[model samples]
Target: MTGYDQILAEVCATGRRLTRAELESRRLLGERAAETGVGLRVLVRQHLAATRTIWPTLGSVDADRVLAAVEQSIDAFAEGHERAQKLAVRREEAARREFIDDLLYGRSDLGRLAERAVRFGLLLTRAHAVAVCQGGTPLDDTDPATRQVESALVARFSERRVLLATKGGLLICIAPADQEEILAHFAKLAHAATDGGRVAVGRAHPGPGGIVHSYEEALHTLDLAERLALDGPVLHAVDLLVYPVLTRDRQAMADLVRNTLGPLESARGGPQPLIDTLTVYFDSGCVAAESARRLKLSVRALTYRLERVHTLTGVNPADPTHRFTLQTAVIGARLLGWPQTEL
Candidate 1:
């Protein structure tokens, strides 16, 4: 508004559109206002106020021409303002992305990371949990589905502590561990928004490094779900902790797999069908009928498969005494990717 009065007076007196230089100056002014956090409405109002002040000063002029000039000036100003705002948003987004990477990966000094977390409305001092959603299609922050989830979560929670991001084509949600509802709601929204993906939640952990651990746990849950053929759409790391312990000793698990089920490889169909029968049987709580139903096999056919397995492996699938060993070996085989990757 400082020099706008003189420009408005010129346009009113001459009954012409704003000169290129004047319009450029107006654009520059708009950019400055945006940079300084001025509202667009306020900027527009100032220009209109200047126009009103100058209107009386002009002895006689075409109202249409003066109106056109003012319109052009304001439009130019708005264009510049919007341009600057967009630039700012991009810069902020980039910073946010960088901070997330460092925070989640523990790539930065803990002190520095904690300070940066504060800027994003996160207090790294409290317990936090990470929930990851892996869908059929890869997703990113810019994806429409991602934005919708982000919007819904923001609208529902309104707590800045909850953050939604995408990493490695997976949707990630971080929320305070104390607020279990936030993570639960996020899992709900993410499952609905994504393409029938599985959502895994890591157990709550305390401190900044805990976030990294939780993120890793969530990621591992997805991996475990695939390896173990888990069908649940929502998985919690806590429920699957035993699997990790079982595989902690790679050699032990491998040896168990090799010794327990290795003989099945010699059976016709190369053990896969037998292995499937065993897995389904164990999963069905050793219920022959349920396992047969799940496998779409006749009861006699499933019984024959189980007998074949027992004959080949020399371990009874039905004996309560042998069930634990057989089940453990089956789990090990899945975890070690035995048949597919070789013992």
Candidate 2:
């Protein structure tokens, strides 16, 4: 029998449990075998050599029978070792999955774990904000430029401790600090990295529990930036408060719109047809025929009114840049109950 099997049988015969010291001694011997550049086969041979000494102390038995039992025990221990290795690997995988989930979902307890991980991995003591980056038009292209940009961000922000994940046309970044210098660095990187790109940045909140919050803010900012057609290489969360204002304080929005455009409303008939044309134009999706039909005027009259609008507002209705401004003004006016003073 193999050494392990013989040891097991001797324990059973003696009705005794091995001490911790004995286990340690055996483990040390195994390690020495490894240190000696011994293969498993050679290690097993050495182990059997030692076992031979112990076997004689037991009552004499057929050498063949002893060898068979020793072989059986060796097989059992190998099986046990393999099972242990599998369990260890499984445990590690589970931990990694749990870590990712916690980072995404914002668990309170997991927040602590995140802090520990960051401090341990990135040497960050505390973080005040997290910034997630959603790749813009140019960055969205699967190219070397994107990877280079990501690498640059990581290297530059190593002190700030940045984590980057780029997948499916999205480049997610987690920036731990909210310092202006750090944010400005990000903006500069973005501007340099992608051509005609856009970046949505979230506001800074308290760190530790702010990763998920920051992610949400980045998403919301991107939506707002896109809707408003804002100029960008960078867009901030604060710039998108107009939509929320429209939703929550319609009267306030209307007031602002009317205050801003009230003069145009009053001057519509006097060299400016802005207020009336805007009302009709927006209502009809800027369609000349529809606006003309609604206003009971010829398309020529509608075009004339639109020209006057451009002159008064200093915004060309046909330009994409002006379209966003017009939309926001129209929405704001609608929300605030416009035409404060009807003509």
Point to the candidate with the largest lDDT: 1
Give one digit per residue, the lDDT tens place, for model 2 in 245-327. 56576556665565556556546354224655676777678788999998889999889877766666677776777876766
Q: What lDDT would candidate 1 get against the real structure?
A: 0.90
In candidate 2, the residue pairs with backbone N, CA or C atoms under 3 Å apart (3 or more residues apart, or in different chains) clash, namely 1-66, 1-67, 1-68, 1-69, 1-70, 1-71, 2-70, 2-71, 254-336
Candidate 2 segments exceeding 4 Å error: 1-101, 119-127, 136-146, 249-303, 306-329, 332-343
lDDT, candidate 2, residue 108?
48
TM-score of 1: 0.94
TM-score versus the correct structure, for each prediction: 0.94, 0.45
Query: Lowest-lDDT window of 10 residues in candidate 1?
Result: 1-10
Predicted structure 2: lDDT: 0.59
Model 2: per-residue Cα lDDT at residue 338: 51
lDDT of 2 at 272: 27
- Candidate 2 positional error at 288, Å: 18
